[model samples]
Target chain A: MNTKILRVNMERLTAEFEELPDAYRSLGGRGLTSAIVAAEVPPECHPLGPRNKLVLAPGIVTGTSAPSSGRLSVGGKSPLTGGIKESNVGSRFAQTLARLGIRAIIVEGQFKEGYKLLAVGKAGAELVDASQWIGQGLYASFERLEEAFRDRVDICGAGVVAEMSARNSGLAFNDLEGRSTRYAGRGGLGAVMASRGLKFIVLDGDGAPGVEVEDKEVFDRGRRKLAEGLKAHDVTKPGGALASYGTNVLINVMNEAGGLPHRNFSSGQDPRAEEVSGERKAELIQKRGGVRPHACHPGCIIQCSEVWTREDGADPMGVLEYESVWALGPNCGIYDLDTIGELNRACNDLGLDTIETGNTLAVVMEGGLLEFGDGAGALRLLEEVRRGTPTGRLLMHGAAFAGTALGVTRVPVVKGQAMPAYDPRAVKGIGIAYATSPMGADHTAGYSIAPEILGVGGKVDPLDPDKGALLRGLQRATAFIDSAGYCLFTAFAVLDFPEALEGMVETVGGVLGTPLTVDDVDAIGKKILDAERTFNAAAGFTQTDDRLPEFMHLETLPPHGHVFDVPAEELDAVLRDG
Target chain B: MMEAPSVTVRLFARLREAAGTSEIALQAQDIRGLLDALVAKAPSVGSELLEADGQLRQAVTVMVNGRNIEFLGGLDTPLRGGDTVAVFPVVAGG
Candidate 1:
């Protein structure tokens, strides 16, 4: 089976398949997405303009029976950050696309005529007019699509926020149960899709040309080795920390370490943190007869995903990840899981990135638009977005815009993107990552919380200032992992198990029909980072754009009473060698 | 016959759930003595926190006065009255 690039030109309403370019043959996922965006898209072009191409690509190992290797990268210039952006999400849509012998789908030009949906299958692909589905939430649109096309196909699309051209909008992908909860939910890529007048993309391939492995013997060997490592590790193993409680497990741990951001970064520790803790959440789910230890995609050994249900076990609100919980819960001074769950559902329905929206709400609360810890007020704020009210439109533009509009100087953001769960003031290494990563305050960009707080990779003092090198190394390694299509959670096992890391690298080699050493893996990651950084540089991003918000340096966080003290020189050193 | 000093022992995550309280006041002179008193006070938490050989479990991170015990003296880290001891199970998330 030969991999092909599927190009959909909304300008001409034509679908064309091109042979994979030799330069892009070896690249997959973020590597391919960033490479295509940098090479084809003019950096100085408006992010939501026709010149900004949106590229979606699956990882190298996707569509294979690789554990947790189902992540898809969506790349484009970000309206939010005004730099290169590669937002990733885990969904079967990526695996299905890979199985169809498609390496990447590049959506270019603009469809000024009307809204349309691009459908791809075993036979071919087509662009169908979809104006009827306009102005509807993603859930209603998806339900209608599934009813019309049958439920077997995987669907991905933008929601109402995209229609409104909200900078904080994100693309949503249907989960295993057809809930549009999984999202490549950052960097305003949804608005980019909306700019092209593409409402949704559906994959309905009946007889997919499955992924071809060059060396089955080597692939099987490496696959088993990696799977064993996942099973052996306490964190990734079945019924372990992740499986049992999901990512929300970090609530109490971060609260205990005084790294969990609370009340809009005013404090680190929240006395009511346990109310939304993983243990309590899991208990509540079990009591409500909801499903636990769930996998987001097929062939995933680490079933870290779960279904959160209402009191009567009706209306499953999708998987509640740690970042969403923290962003909606303690960040806004609300601890009730029901409130967070409702807010999460609202974000998913409206197609707003939860992290950005949560941060935006906190900023508005700080600006005195609403009282902190007011769950009802927060729900009403989300309603304002659904109604497309003027205030909702402002809030939907994300934390930076809302902060600027309200004259609130305490916005916790870097390069326009809001930071995630871990407060950088306390978790110093992550602060370096937040400041330096091209993705703008993305925890998954480096994830120093593993070493600093969780003690996974190696123990780093959470308060240490001398972690520039560590953050840089983690960023390099993570770039490779993202390009390879493995879930970031797999790092917990790969870092501790040498053989697991080797097996993962070897599996890629087996799939590509080439011999790759550990050195090659590092090169691939560095190459991706270089491409991203070069694109951002050409887009006019300087060292100043790579720094955290000014208030982080001025205000000290509570509990530990620490400020983000990582030197500017150290932040600049992150990608210098690359 | 010296009076036993009281240290505030803080539990987080699953440990707090197991102990049914976030903080516990225990009488002990040092870190080891504190653990013994803690296990005696909450028998259900002993297996979760300590191994059969009486060593702290690998998943349990113990900190004395906001400093990791590994940086200080491990289980031998001395604690004075009114010192805060925080214990947590190794947890992670993105």
Candidate 2:
């Protein structure tokens, strides 16, 4: 099998394809990304400097009809973490890139130009002038790309917020039929892209050759069985719970379990919780003509992406899921879905991580920037990024920096990455994940919602710390799964049916022409984790770096009323191998 | 007075939805005895709640309050007066 790499130099505006090393042939997703970044990019270079390279990789299962195996990983020196950072998104990019026989794309150096976009396809690469599109929102940029490229291509673009060089900016991707629905949306990576003078990336897969697989028959059967498993499960079946309500389905359950973060991680339960819940969201979408939950990718069965609409239904905002809604909705105390939807639209247009933006806004409100639940004020704050005002620059830097500028002591971040909606104090397992994960407090790293909230894989109490070791096991398993190019939602089926593992390994072996056991799968995951840890340690990270905010230890969440009692010493046990 | 036969029944998550009540009162002496009594008394709820082992199935959490009786007490948490048992199906959301 011939593996190819595309290396683009921004300073010289040059590009080349290099042969993959024999060792990297088996690597996929995070394995490929972490390894490449650790090897090629210097650990101590300024993250936004020309020395840093952004690596985009597809998983091993990419290009196959595997269920939910379309996540693409983007790795670099995180502007947020200052450590090895890899963020993945469930977009068509990975599947498309894999089908085009592209395993990884390495973007290096910086373009001297202030604004530009890169267009890639089977034909090759081009530096497109983006002057006309400067300050364009994601939706507008997507619309323009669709108009220009037609249905022949997919586009990855950042919003005007990135052009302004805001820290919270994220790179957004066009979903199926060209909606700005998916995002490489975390850790201020968009700012890095903007700093490199990259405004957008358009991938045209038209006429591209498909991926090569050794055993098509075994691939077909294995993939089919895995698809059947997802179809059989309630959470993963088409029009399943995720499709019906997006990820906001967690609102009710998390509230009942007392893990929902309200008013900036200060409490667990919000009396206004229902106002932002999945059921309520479903009802609101129905009333507003924006209710349909569509898939982000063309072949995705679990359609958890939604096209949020204005209350008047005059214009369609980008998709808003659990993290966005919570970040813009309850985390900042805004209950009106339309208002939250507007903020979501604004962030997408400006290319910002809604979670960080929402959390940062709440922190600003806590510092008396605005009253909590000020929906209009929040809207105005986002408008600043759109306008590229001075305050807009400060607001766009995200929560950690914004908190520092505001002199606020209650910044909720780990390794500079903002916390997702789940309060760590209430959900202790995820807390351990947040504290120990090299990527910072990202639940997607080791989502404990399964055991804590969903009752999958033997229920564990959300408030208990006794299951730290078990939680770490799940996290390690999840890391492997993510790297394999399987969608994290696939865990819903796998957790219930252990046979799914055999099916996945069989499929992998068939496609790669290599016999791989489930043990190999476990080893691949460990290798990825070890590589990331090595990068972080080399970049000056240590066990002391993995810790939750001090307030979590002292403050208690109400309504069940508990604090994170897990000692730092015990929390560190997650990194120790048995 | 005639003696009454009894067995403990557990509830957990969302099983409380079907059981009408958290803990139900049974007058049977064994696992089979309690299930038969449960099916006979709350026939509308029994088939949905109990499995063939007389144990609750997937999506069902049958715990005797603080303890998952499945691990501790089984369907026999040794019932006594005022022991509020709970039954629930696995919640659909989250």
Candidate with maximal DockQ: 1
**Strongest candidate by TM-score:** 1
Q: Report model 2's TM-score to 2 decimal places.
A: 0.89
Estimate TM-scores for all models: 0.97, 0.89
Q: Highest lDDT among the candidates is held by which one?
A: 1
How do the residues A79-147 of candidate 2 rate in per-residue lDDT, one tens digit apiece? Answer: 878898888887887888888788888888898767676777887777877878876667777887878
Question: Which stretches of candidate 2 lie above 4 Å from their native place?
Answer: A291-293, B1-55, B60-94
RMSD of each: 1.7, 4.6
Error of 1 at A397 (Å): 0.8
Q: For candidate 1, lDDT tens digit of each residue in A214-326?
A: 87777787888899999988789887778988999888778877888898888999779989989889889999998898988888888899999877889998999999999
